[model samples]
Structures are given as structure tokens and as C-alpha cells.
Target: MLAYRMRHRIQFQRRVQTQDPNTGEIIVSWETVLFSGRLDVPAEVLTGPGRELIAADAQQAETTARINCRWFPVDRLELYTWRILWDGRIFNITSAETDRTARQEWRLRCSDGLTDGQ
Candidate 1:
């Protein structure tokens, strides 16, 4: 793994839901920092076929990033409840997978069009 290539710093945030003190209303917040480290975010390029597939589904485009496990040790549970913050942008993680042969890195499929407002 090219550790030097992980130049883009990113923050992993987990959504937490809690009840209000007096109002007794459930509030959503993202104050937990699960991990903070450098990542490699390459520009996404969709081919003709790939574009067609997305168009058919009416799905918004997404950006994928690769993170080194040495820098950020993320587990499966965290993957489902965490989102990434990079360069003032919020990215919702669609999937997180590690290589079967070498679990030193994690590929995160993310989307910028969606937010954790719900």
C-alpha cells in the first residue's frame, strides 16, 4: 500500500440519536468522531455503459475512496452508521469492503447526493 498516496485528510462521523432534556423529542446529531485520517479520493469516471445503468435507475452519481486500515481501523458495525467528511463535503458510505487477500486497505463506496437528515 502506498501510504504516501493517502494525502487527503478526512473525518469519519457517526450519527447519534438522543432524546431531548425537557422537550422529550428525539434529536439526531453527528458529534462522534469514529476516525480521522488521510485517504485517497480519486475522481470518479463513468463509462458509457455505466452512465446508462445509472440513468436507467435514476440514481445519483457517487464517489469512491480508498482508505488504509493502518490509518483508520474501521469495523463492519461502524461502516453501517458512519459517514465521511472531506473538504467541507459530506459523503454517505454506501458500502465498505476490504480485499480478501490483504485486509490492509478498505474501499468505500460513497454518495454525496444524500444526507443523514432523516
Candidate 2:
């Protein structure tokens, strides 16, 4: 059996804004994100026509969207929505702020047994 090895890692960085209730000045915070995962391609999947390996450069360029003060404001009374970009689509993942600091393994593989046809 053979496995597709990941050639590189995915990374993200964020800037958050906090405000002084009294001064109304914005304070910025920076966060670094790191993700490691593999891409699984099944032999049963097709490699031509509708089924093809996704472009290597595009796949390697995949990175998580950055969440900033514009998305999550400090003065705002409500929580902001989180956004994620997969493939070429932009999606909203959550409507609440992630108020915790914890690291866990995040795995994402194409079970569809298809690549981007590149």
C-alpha cells in the first residue's frame, strides 16, 4: 500500500482588535495558526475526466482565512461570524468567537477519491 505524503504545512495568522470601553481606542492582538494534515486518494477514484488530481500548486496554496477586528469587533455587542475558504468557495463556519486556546489535530482528506483534475 502506498500513501500520499504531504509536502508542506498549512499556516494562518490573525489580528484581533480590542477596545477600551472608555477611550474607544482599538488594541490589536496577533495570533499564529498552524495546521498539519494529509490528503488521501483512493485507488477506486477516477483520475480522468470528472475525476482528476487537484492542482498541486493550488492545493499547496490552501490556507485558512484570517479573522480580524473587522470580522470580530471589540465594540460590537454581538458576536461575529467566522469564515473559511475551501477549494474556491468561501463559507461561514461559526457565528461566535472562539474564546479558547487549545490545540488539537485537524485532519482533512478527500474521501471522494478524486483530485482537482490537475
Candidate 3:
């Protein structure tokens, strides 16, 4: 049997959203970057939060992207507040609410073209 060992001491999760700039439509391309301080590892993925934003027969106009990242502390042993980046803007979201739930899932949403309708 292979012994399982944690290669890195720390781990993190990052969620990102990409959208079209001109039409405000969601774009499926343009990979997002995610970093882990302790693990020194990075990964990228598509289809999150605003996945519904993508429509058939649609052409990307412009691009807007959002990223939500989280880091877990070794001592604290708890889910901490997360940071997010949206279209070159950075914001923070608290994990206070997560404590109340058994399982928590965070996501970043991107919407540029479609609106709620006036």
C-alpha cells in the first residue's frame, strides 16, 4: 500500500468567473490563476457560479472575471475569510456564515451582458 502523506502543509481554493466585455456575456475561455502559499501549488478550472451566463450561439464581446480564494490555517483548523478579485477589483468575504453550516461552497459570479431587465 502506498503511504499517504501531505506533500504540503497548507492548501487553498480559488473560484473565478469570466465574462464578455462588450455584450456582458459569459466567456468559457481565458484561464484564471490560483495560488497556494503553503502548498506552492496552483490549479485552474471552468464552470462556476454564473455558468448559466453562457448561452448557445453566442460570441464573446468583452471580458469580466471574478475570483474567490480561501486559505486554511494549520493551527486555527477553521475556514477563514476569503478574498475575491473581480475585473481587477479585490474584495473580501467573511466565513462567519460558513460556520453555521456543515458544508460550505463559495463561488464567484460574472455578469456583463445580460441584465435583470429594466
Candidate 4:
């Protein structure tokens, strides 16, 4: 995708646990990992009539974002622990793909959830 289409700012987060020193309680939170990235809507979302496409997409699943960011090494085993936040919506990291050939960028497939991350 062109850099211009990546106008949205996306943040990467991971689930983390911390101890409340005084209360001895375990605190769970989403910690920011990579600062932010340029984001873009996948082509499928823009292929048809605006209203009709949105209506059809809504029936299937929550919003999905294709986040494009400069290449970075990500531990594959920990993919499930990540989340992407953009425009105030927090998304579960459904999958992550790397551009091994060029090693110039990586994309993430994220889906918004209704539970805790919301």
C-alpha cells in the first residue's frame, strides 16, 4: 500500500500483568509495544458501493484493519498476545504476516472485539 493511504495511526499493545505492591492485587493492562504505525483499510472494504459494502461487512464481523508498519522482528509464538488500537477502537490480533523477501514492511490483521479490550 502507498504511504499516503496509511493515514490512520495504529498502536500495538500486549496484555500485561502487574502487581499492586500495596494491595497485593494483580493488575491486568494493555501495554503499548511499538509506538504507532500507519494503517490502511484492506482492499475488500473499498471494492463496492459504500453503504452496501459496509452493511455486508457489518453482518460478518467487526472492523478489520490492515496495519502497515516498517519491518520489525516479532516473535511468532507471541502473536496471539498482541492487540492493535486505532481511532479509539482496540482490536484483537487475529494474525500477523511478515514481508520476508523485502523486509521492508509487515502487516497485521486485526479485528475489534466486544469484550475487555473494548
Alpha-carbon RMSD to native, per candidate: 5.5, 14.7, 13.0, 6.5
Positional deviation of residue 64's Cα in model 3 after best superposition, in angstroms: 34
The segments of candidate 1 whose C-alpha lies over 4 angstroms from its true place after superposition are 34-73, 116-118
Native-referenced Cα lDDT, model 2: 0.29
Error of 3 at 93 (Å): 20
Worst 10 residues of 1 by lDDT: 44-53
Better of 3 and 4 by lDDT: 4
Q: What are the Cα lDDT values of the candidates?
A: 0.57, 0.29, 0.31, 0.59
Off by over 4 Å in 2: 1-4, 20-23, 27-30, 34-105, 108-118
Per-residue accuracy of model 4 over 12-101 as CA lDDT, tens digit each: 677888999999999988767743343433221111121213343564335555666666566855866877667676767667677767
* lDDT over C-alpha atoms for residue 71 of model 2: 20
Query: Backbone clashes in each candidate structure, one number apiece?
Result: 0, 7, 8, 0
lDDT of 1 by residue, 7-112 (tens): 6656667788899999999998886463333343322221122122254568755444434443246577677677766777676776777766545666666666
Model 4 regions more than 4 Å off: 34-61, 100-102, 116-118
Query: In candidate 1, how many clashes are counted?
Result: 0
Instruction: Report the alpha-carbon TM-score of model 3 versus the true structure.
Output: 0.21
